[model samples]
Target chain A: MKLLSGEIISNEKCGKGLYKIEVFSPYICRNANAGQFVNVKCSPDGILDPLLRRPFSIYNVEKEYNVFSILYLEKGKGTKFLSDLKKGSNLNFAGPLGSSISIGDRSKNFLLVGGGIGIAPLYFLARTLIQKGKNIFFAAGFKDNNFIEWSGELTRLGINYRIFTEDGSWGDEGLATDFVKENIKKYKNYKIYCCGPRDMLISMQDILAGKKISVTALLEERMACGVGVCRGCAVKIKDGNGSFVYKTVCKDGPAFDLMEVIFD
Target chain B: MIEGSGINLSVNLGRIKLKNPVVTCSGTFSSGLEYSEFYDVSILGAVTTKSFSFVSRAGNPPPRIWETTCGMLNSIGLQNEGIDFFIKNHLPKIKSLGAKIILSIFGDDPGEFKKIAREVKKVESSLLAVELNLSCPNVKEGGIAFSSMPAEVEKITEAVCKILEIPLIVKLSPNSDSIIESAIRAKCGGAEAVSIINSIVGTAIDIDTFKPRLGNVTGGMSGPAIKPIALAKVYFLAKADILPIIGMGGIYDWRDAVEFLVAGASAVGVGTANFVDYEAGKKIIEGIRNYLSKKGINDINKIIGKAIC
Candidate 1:
């Protein structure tokens, strides 16, 4: 991975508490892959207030223009500071960090599941699989219709997708995991890839396990160095010897087999 | 005028000689594998591996770290894969890097410390020294307990010193009532050097949630915020003339490293700075060379304790 300065091409509020920031950084975009993330230095140079860089998944990449976008929620001080930046502001970021999802066997059908902001990386994966002429299905959940983002892009790509919202204001009045359970038998032959809140992922894992369907889930944790060095962002995974070992989320995976993970 | 390449950055920490005075502090650098992507690990004086014990540790749970004013607090609980894993998986790669290796060992008591040290001696040959991590304030046992008391510090040092062939450097905690006394006791116990000022015990509370920010409730604080306190400790240790000091705490740049040197550190370690910049150790090495060349001081040893005498 390389540390490069990315100039903001545009920053817009895409939905409630959501932002889509597009940056022009050839160094990162050229090498970035699906499921990888960038560690952004949110605070300005010489200011160490929010000392650590925040990690955001690569939402999309436009290689022709050497541009990439990150989808994030204005959750804390670091992200709030990020939202205030105008067009053409240069931000320092390190990427394309963490292990990418295994595309594996393009001939196999793919089913993608995303929840809230977790949809960020899944969008990139969907785009990639669609371009390869692979049959893809997307199932996403937001708090409500007001929080939904990226459905239009999915339509433009001509990819089949389903949306769910908790308050019945959007398609399907239920949680994402409920939707996945209802549709599991229909997509029995497809390989499943999921990204969402920890509870959603875990519950979905239980549903998939009972059906004997394998899945890959993208995990998230508070991290210091988005590299393996600090041993921050560790998640327990079953070793080959049947014992659990702490694998760093930033390195060993941001994407791991749903079966191997031991969530606390 | 001294040539740029001719500046002597090598340092002698009693029995061990380092190519330079810039060592990656334990727990931050991670055995040189992670930072190797940025720069060669051998360029640093030595790479101190994360401290380990006889048994593998799972470490603390989530929210292990939290950001503070100018630094960060971490209670990683000395998370490691134990000594056997180090010998089997990590040591070969670290040895291949060609940097002087200093194994940081942590144990609850004197016998455990000796056991770990004995195992380390049989497997590794290129070790510059074994730094006894007696001052980690985060762990529930065997960390600050040994360093806080003078007699325990002496006992552990002497116990490990007896079994090891290489030099023993006792790392002392700044949280103690008398750091000087601790250093003196380490010297009396046959430690060749002492690396002072491990992170101070600290805590942070989330104003919104009205709860502790870290899962461990408290952790050891490090980064630019602790540099001044580290310098003062180094200055005090220098005044006592106990042993060669390997000083560190919140070192961010070359100027910070120099401050420790002038305060009387035979060598300086870069810790939290590694997180801010992966190549911080290399940059600090260059910065020290430039500072020495500009001042027309050809030898780095000449600058040690210059602030006092």
Candidate 2:
């Protein structure tokens, strides 16, 4: 079903240069999955730069009143325009699209690694797994401690959470991949999930190359159509012919098994 | 006060009623259908499907798009699931949308359009219209972009019009020197409507990298920059008899829609604007409504071709 256009019920600056815009999209809030996303059209009048829709991972969805939230860093014109939206402003978007994470196949003991805004989907994944009695360990990487937004929930749920900042002002100094590599031995039988920059995922893949750890990595790439028709978001995959064929990131997955995809 | 603010604007495309005109350009929002759940689909005037072909196309490799100052360049290579798969999986779902569905169909030759259109006509209840993407640059045929010549455009338009009983919208290419001639041929071939212009042929160079921005080396450009050219082509096409005009090119708001209407379009297709604002269509509707009210006009049709006069 098509999601209804949302009104910006509120906008507030949560941290330095980062803002949270709450939209009342009942349809989306109710149907959006943890790993899904929404394509937001930033300029209502079309005078802005980058005249194309921007896709963001579902940060959170409140099904009760049908409210959805996106936490973003005001990086480009699109984000800047979104940040400027006031209460009662209307924003058009479409979503809860893309391949969702199937929690049914995951192990009871789970480890989630996120970097920057990649933490968006991790929050929802951790919450769902925790509800099912999955032992959750979430480690995040950011430029600074100000980027951490899940402290209270992590504490309340009794989920073991760690933070790594690039400047070493947070829990650790290096990338989140190192922590996964160093700690993989301790959680040998656990399922590993990660979302972050390409380098981080690639580095993690190298560390677990010979290990017995199962990994599901979320990738970010350029996509033209959210559906498989565009072929703009094709990622290399094993075809029936035993050769690597192109499958859509939006359809085949934003999340794929480590063995199924080939990284640059 | 801005025009779109405080306006309850929405529209219906086929069966789906969008909250507005602002929508992601086809091939720009590749999160898949799932993303529609988190965002507002009702805010768009319509959701145009990505260009599809007779068979599944792998499209071009990575670096398919590059962001320019006011627009984006893309050479997606017209990747698709083929018409058969689209009907099997996508058709059933599109029928359920609250907004209108515009199918963008691309083919290598005239026969492909007719074949796809025939199949699509079977599920016409799910769609508002079929957009002929005969204009996309040919990936396999040394980039001999279709819709550039009048003969090819006429051939495809006539072929699809023969098979499909529903509205046939031919999307025209801006790369051609004589856009009106192509429009005339399409109209003569029985196009129910004509949409122009589909991205200008362009290329972007990376200064430091010393290479073209797109993987295909060349791409079609869309955004505000192309608005003038699109408007001119649309105006020329509107001069012809029969069928309606769906004008598009960097349309961001109500004023843009008005321009298209004056230039001889019945309805406007908003593409590039979706990237800037998802609610652009809604806002544009509101803006147009207010403009109409202020001008003491009850029906929008009165303004059609007014600019040409």
Candidate 3:
């Protein structure tokens, strides 16, 4: 991975408390994949406030223009500083980090599940899968109607998708877990790829347990060095012998088999 | 005119000699597992592994780290697969890289420290030195308490030093009552060198949640914010002439490393800076060589205490 300076091409408010920032970095955009992320240095030089770089999933990549975008919410100090960045400012970023989601056997049906902002990476994955001429089923859940901004893009891509909202003011009412529990058995041979809050992932895992389906989750944790040197962002994984070993989310995965995760 | 190629960056820490003075701090470099993928691990002075105990530690839960202004607070609780795993799985790989290895050992008491040190000595070969980490502020039992007391520091250092054939480097804590006194005690206990200023104890709170930001409630703070405090400590230790100080705190680049060397450090450790820039060690090495050549200083040893009057 290379540490390159990215100039902001545009930063726009895409949804409620969500932003889509596109940056110009040929080095990162050329090598970036679907599930990989970028560690963005939000603060300016000589400013130590908000000292760590925030890791964001690669939302989209336009290799022709050498531009990549990241979808983020105003969660804390780092993103709050990032939200204030303008069109012409320079941002130092290190990336194409973390392991990418493995697409095994393109002939099988690909079922993608995402919750809230976790859909950022899944959008990239769906685009790649569609281009590969694979059968894709996408389902996303948001808190309310204000978060359904990506539906338009999904439609333009001619992707068959379902949207759910907790407030019942949007599409289907209830969690994404409810959607999976209702229609998961319809596909014969499939692999489930999911990303979202831990609660949502766990709920879906509970419904899929003891089944023949294979599920890979794009996990999330508070990370410092996205390069795996700092030993931050560790997640416990159960080995084959029913014991748990600590694997870092930055290196060993931002993706892991759902069966291996020992979510405490 | 021997301007670029004649610059020598080698350094001597007690009986141990290093190719350069840039070392990765303990608990940051991950025993050369992750960093070797980015750059050659042997380019630095030495690679200090993360602190390991006798038994495996699960460490703290999620939210173990929090970002502050110019620094970070972490209570990782010394997570490791224990000394046994390091010897079996990690040592051969680290040894193969041909980098000087300084094994950092931590424990809950003097006896535990001696036990782990003895075990490490028996299995590992080509070890440059053993760093006894007496100043980890995250754990409650054997960390800050031992380093805070001069008598306990002397006891632990002497206990660990008696068992090993290699030189012992005692890592000091900044939160102690008197850092210089602690260093002097380590020297009396036969420590070859001292690594100053392990992360200082600090805390942060979430304004909206009205609760602690870190899962451990408190953690040791490191980065640029702590550089000034670390520099002063290294200066005082060097002024006292207690022992050769391996100074570190908020070292980001070559200028920061040079500041530590001039403040009386025989070597410098790069910790939190690795999180910011993964290739910081390589960049700093080049920066130091360029600075030395430009200043017409042939040997790095001449600049060890150049700033001290």
- Which candidate gets the maximum DockQ versus the true structure? 1
Q: In angstroms, give how far residue B211 of model 1 lies from its true place.
A: 4.2
What are the per-residue Cα lDDT tens digits for candidate 2 across A1-264?
Answer: 353478998878777777777889877876777778777777654356555667777777767768888877788888888888899989877777787788874477888989887887777778678768888889888878777554554566679888888889878897777788788788788888888887787887788888878888777777654544455566776665766767767667788886667764
* lDDT-based ranking: 1, 3, 2
List, residue by residue over A82-137, the lDDT tens digit for candidate 1. Answer: 99989998878889999977677644688889999898999999888877788988
lDDT of 3 at B175: 93
TM-score of the second chain for every model:
0.97, 0.84, 0.97
True-contact fraction per candidate equals 0.46, 0.40, 0.61
Q: What is the C-alpha lDDT profile of model 1 across B1-309, one tens digit per residue?
A: 124578888898888888899998999988888888889988889998889888788888767778888899888888898888988898888888787789888997888887898788797576888989999998878788877688999999888888887998888999878788888899888999999889999999989999898888998999889999999999988988889999999888899999999999999999988887778899999999999989998899999999975
For B134-244, candidate 3 gives per-residue lDDT tens digits of: 999999888999777888889988988778888889999999777888888898898999998899999999999998988789999999999999999999889888888
lDDT for each residue of candidate 2 in B35-64, tens digit (9 for 90 to 100): 354354544556677777878887776677
Q: DockQ score of candidate 1? A: 0.60
Interface RMSD (C-alpha) of each candidate? Answer: 1.3, 4.4, 1.6
